[model samples]
Target chain A: MRVSAPVRATVQRLTLPFLIFMSALLAVLGKADVLLFDRVRVVLADVLAPVLQVAGEPIASVSRAVGTVENVITVYHQNQELKLENQRLLQWQEVARRLQSENEELRNLVKFAPQGAVSSVAAQVIADSGGAFLHNILVNVGSREGVARGQPAMTGDGLVGRVIEVGGRTARILLLTDINSHIPVAIEGTHDHAMLNGDNSDEPRLVYVQPKTPVKSGDRIVTSGSGGMFPPDLPVGVVASVGGVIRVETYADLARLEMVRIVNYGLDGILPDGWVPTPQAGRRSHARAASSP
Target chain B: MPYSRNRDYVGFVARMVPGTTTFLFTLLSLLPFPVPSFGSIAPSFALMAVFHWTVYRPDLLPPGAVFVAGLLLDLLNGTPYVGLSALALLLVRTAVLNQRRIFSHRPFSVLWLGFFGATAGAFALEWAFVSLMQVEFLAPRPFVFQTLITAACFPIGSYVLALAHRAMPALSA
Candidate 1:
C-alpha cells in the first residue's frame, strides 16, 4: 500500500482533471433530450428513494409535532382570534359567494368554457440542497405517480417550486429560491409584470419591471401564469425592501418544508388549440353517457 | 515483514478514507435545504469540512481531491460550469498547503484567521463569478450571512475532523 513518491504525485495530478471530465460529461448528458435523461434520472432517483424516505421521516415527525404544538397554543387564543378572523373571513366569504355566482354566470355566457381539468398528488420532501449556491429538494414522487417534469409544486402557504427532474419514485424540485429558477410574476397592487429570478439566495429579485411602475414595500406578488407553467394568481410573496432592492418574501417557509402538493394541471394542452387530456373530463368519459342519440 | 505490511495497509486505508469522506461531505453541503428570506445563501458545510481536513490531515486530503469535490458540488448543485468552484477550492488548498507550517505551531486564533482568510477568498471568487454572469441583485445578504455561519461552524468541524483523525491509528503517523 506504500506508494512511491512519483506514483503519489501522478495520482494527485490526474484526480482533478478526471473528476472535472466526469462532471462535464454528466452535465452534457443530462441536457440531451429531457425525455431520455428524464427516464434515467427517474431510475436513479428511485434507487435513492429509500434514502430520501428514511431521511424525510424524522423531519416530517418533527414538523408535525411542531404543528400540533402551534395548534394547541393557538387554541388558548382561539376564541378571541377566531372572532376577529371570523369577521374578516365572513367578509371574504361574501365576496367569494358573489364571485362564484358571477363566475358561473360568466362561464355560461361564454358558451364554450375551456373544459380543462386538473388532477393532483401529494409528495414528501426527501432531501434538500441547503447551501448558498443551490436550491433544490428531492421529493418522493415520480413518473409512477403521474408526476411529470415541469409540474408546479406548492406548500399550504403558497408556491414552493416546480419539478425539474422526475425519477421513477422520486423527483427533484427547483425551489423558487434557487439561483437558476425564474418564473413570470405580477404585482397584485399594480398589475405590473416581472420575472421572479432566484439568485441562489432566499429573497428572489423582481426583474423586468418597468422603472416608472409604482411598486412599493408590502405589495403582494402572484404568479402571472403567462407561460401557462403555473396556475394564474397563485400567491407568491410580499414585496419587501432589503436594503434598497425590492425582494419578495415568499409565503412558503422553505426551512420547514416537509410535504408538498404536486398540482397536475396540464399546461401543455391548456393553451389555445392544444389537445391535452383534462383529468375531470377523461374520468367522466369512462362512465355512461347522459344522453345519446 | 507482516508488521510492515499491516502498517502499509493501515496507511492505505487512512489515505483513502479522507477522499471518501470529502465526497460525502461535499454531498452533505450540497443538500437543498432552504434558509429563510436571507436570500439564497445556505451555509458552506463542504468548505468547512475541506478546510478542517486540510488543516489537520494534509497527507490524507490532497489538493486535487479538494478540486474534484468542488467540481462535484458544482455539478450536483447545477451551477454554470465546473471551473468556478474548482478554482476556488484550488486556491484554498494552495493557501492551506503553503501556510501549513505556520498553522501547525500556532494557537487556535491563528488557525481561525487562516480559515477566515480562505473563506474570504472563496466567497469573493464565487461572488465575482456570479456577478460577472449578470446576476448581481439576487440576494447578497444571504451569502454574507452564509459566510459568517460557515466561519462559525469551522472550529466545531475542525474538532470533529481532528477526533476522526485521532481515531484512525494510521493518520497519526
Candidate 2:
C-alpha cells in the first residue's frame, strides 16, 4: 500500500515551482489588498503577538541591564553636561514664560477656544518587522484601547509613525523609515514644508522642497498638520543634512523604542476618517464655502 | 520487537523537531534588538536553518514547512514586496538541494562558500524584484549588508543545527 518512490520524487520536484508561483501570487494579492490575504495577515498578527511579547521580554531585559552598565561608566560626564545644559535652559525658561503669557493674551482677544487636549494610550512594542526592506513594529495596544488606524505612535522624543492595522489586542505601526511612509512636515525656522519619505533607510529623505526654499542643515522639523494625517507641531527630528538631498535624523531612535503613545488629536479634518469626498459632496462643499464667504 | 514500531512512530514525530526549532529560530531572529545602525544587520538565521536542514535532512524538512515559514515572515514584516521571504527561502532550498551531491560530504569551509553563492543569488533576485516593483533603482546597501551579515552568520547557525541534529534520536531509514 506504500506509494511509489518515483511518484514521491515527482511531487518533490513540483513542490518548489508551485511554492514559487504561490509566493508571487500572495505578493500580488497582498499588494492588491485581496480581502482573504488581508484577513490572513490580521489573524497571523493576532496569533503571533503573544509569542513575540514573551520572546521580546528577555531581550529587552538583557538590553536594559547592558544600558545600566554603560550609564554607570558615563555618569560623571553626564552630570557635568547636565549642569551646563541646565544653565542655558534656565535662561530659555524666562523667554518661554514671557511668550506663554503673550500668546494667552492674544488667544483671549480672538476668543479662541484653543484645541482640546489629546489623550494617548501607551503600548509596548512586542515585535519588529525584521526585514531590511520593511520598517514596522507590532505594539501591544489595539482597538480595545481605543487605538485606530491612522493614529500617530510616538515616544517622548518625537513622532514614530502611524498605526496601519489595528487588531483586537495588537496593532502594527508603520515606522517613519518605512518606504510607504510619507509625512508632510515643516522646518522650524524657515517654515518650509516638505514631505518626509522613508526609503527603508536609516535617515528618511525630505522631498518636494521648493528649490528656492532656504533649508539648512540641523534645522528642526515638526508635523505641519497640512493634510491632517498627524497632529500639527509634533516634534519630528532635526534636518540631519542638506547636501544634494535633505535627510532627517528622527528624534525617536527607532531601534530603541520600547513604549509609545498613540495620540488622538481629534482634529483630523483635512482627511478625517470615513470622510470620502465624492464628486457631489465636493461640489456641495465648494458651493457652501463660496456662499458663506 | 513489538515495541520497535512504537519507537519508529517516535522517530517520525522526532523528525519534526528541526522544522519546529528552525521556525522558532526564524521568529526570534526577527525580534528587535535596539542598536544603532543595526537595522540592516538582521542575519538570516532562518536562511541558515533552511540550508542546514535541506542539505542534511531533505526528506524530513519538506517544502511546505519552508513555504509556511516564509509566508509567516512576509505577513509579519509587512513587506508586500519581498513577497515575504517565502520565494527566496524555497529558491535557496532548491539550490542547496541541487548541490547536495557536492555539499553533503564537504568540509565546513566549502559549505560556507556554497552559502555565499546561494546568498548572492537570493539577494540578486530580491534586489531585482524590489527594483522592478518600485520602477526605480532601489539602493542595494541594505540588501548587501544583510547578505554579508547573514552569510557571516552561517557557520554559527550550521554549528548549532549540527548540535541539534546530534542531540535528536536517530531516524530509522
Candidate 3:
C-alpha cells in the first residue's frame, strides 16, 4: 500500500524521537534486569571472539615490537636492577625453603588435610570494555576452557580481577577499578578487614577499614576470602594514599594487561554457575556475615 | 540488462558501505590498543564513522543504524546501561544532521573543531548520566581524557573514512 507523501514525511519525522525515547527507557531499565543483556552479551562475545582475535593480531605484534625496542635501550639499566632484585629474591628463597619444611612438619603433626586441587588457564587479552566509565577485559579462554564466573584472574604480580561473564570461547573479567566491583579484602599484616571498592579510577579505594588500626600508606592489601569468591591471601595491591579516600595501587599493571591467569580455587563461593549478582544484591551482606567470625 | 543488473548490484553494495563501516568502527574501538597509560578509554571510532556518514551520506547511514551500532558497543562493553551509548549516538547523529551543510566542503580545521565540541558534549552527557545513575559524583578525569583523546585522534579516523568515502563514487559509476 502506497502512503501519501505527507503521511510518509510525518512517520519519518517521528522515527527519531521514538528511537531516542526507547533507548533512554532501555538504559534506565537495563539496571533493573541485566539477566537478558547478560545472556545476549555472552553469546555475542563468543561469536565475535574469533573476529576480535584475528583483528588484534597486528596490534599485539606492534606492541611487542615496541617493547623489544625499549628493552634494548634500557638493557643496561634493567640488568643492574635485575641483579639487585635477584640478590634479594635469593635471600627470600632460602627463608621460604626453610619455612616450607617446617610447615610440612607442622601439618603432619596436626594431621591437617590440604585444600582441594587448584586449576588455572592462561588466556590472552582479546578485548577491552573501552568505555570511560567501564573497566573490564575479555579474555580468549571461557567456559569451554574450564573458566567459571567469579574465578579470580591474576597476573604474576597480583590479582587483576574476577571473571564475571563467561561465554563458550570468551570470558569478561571485571577489573578491580570498575565502579560496580567490590571485593572483600584486608590489610595484609593486621588482617583488618575492609572492602576494596572500585570507583572508576586507576586506583581503587579501600572502604570499611576497622579504623582501630590506622592504615598507613604502603600497607599491603590481600583478599580476605570472606565471601569464598577468592581464595585467601591473594595479593591485591598496596595502599597508594591515606587521604580522605584511601586508594590502592594494584600490583598488576591494569593499564597494559596482555595476559591473565584465570585460577579456579575449587570454592563454589557466593555466585553459582548462572547467578549474576547485581550491585544491590544481598551477597555483600552474606559476605559480611561470613567474615564476622 | 545484465550490465544494468551489475551496476545495480554495485550500487547496492556502495549504499551498504556507510552502515558496514560504522559497525566495523564500533568493533575497532573495542580492540585493546596496548597504549601505555591509556587505561580503559579507547577512542570512540564509532562516533567518527557516524559523524562522517551523517555529514556526507545521511541517506545511507540512518538513525536506526546508529542506534544499532551504539547498542552493539554497549553490549560488548558489558555495561549495565545498555542503551546509554545508543541514546548518545542518536543525539549526536541528529545534531550533526541539522548542521550537515556547515561541515560539508569545509576546511579540515573547522571539522576538527566541530568534532571536538561534539566529543565534549557526548562525554559530558555520559559523565552526568552515570553519576546520576550511581547517585554520586563520579570522577570526571577519565571522561575528560576520553573526550580529549577522541578529538585529538579525529584526524586519523577521518582520514580512514575519507578513503572509503572516495571509493563510493567509483562504485556507483
Query: List-wise, what DockQ does each model earn?
Result: 0.27, 0.51, 0.75
Candidate 2, A185-251: lDDT as tens digits: 8788776677787887889998777578767888899987666577678999998888887899999
Candidate number with the higher lDDT (1 or 2): 2
Interface RMSD per candidate:
7.0, 4.3, 1.3
TM values, all candidates: 0.73, 0.87, 0.94
lDDT tens string, model 1, A73-169? Answer: 8886888888999999999999999999999899889885674788888987666665556577778788889987778888888998877776688
The C-alpha stretches of model 3 lying farther than 4 A from their native spots are A1-7, A74-95, A272-277, A282-293
CA displacement after TM-score superposition, residue A216 of candidate 3 (Å)? 1.2
lDDT of 2: 0.78
C-alpha displacement of A230 in model 3, angstroms? 1.0
Model 1 residue A2 lDDT?
Answer: 98
- What lDDT, from 0 to 1, does candidate 3 have? 0.90
Pairs clashing within candidate 3: none
lDDT string for model 3 (A100-182, tens) is 99999999999999999999999999988988999999999988899999999999999999989999999999999988888
lDDT of 2 by residue, B1-173 (tens): 86898888877767877798778878877677776545456777778888888888887778889888887777776665535578888889988988798887778888999988888788778778777765667788888888898899888888888988886766534
Best by lDDT: 3
Each prediction's Cα RMSD? 8.9, 5.0, 2.2
Whole-model Cα lDDT of every candidate shown, in order: 0.68, 0.78, 0.90
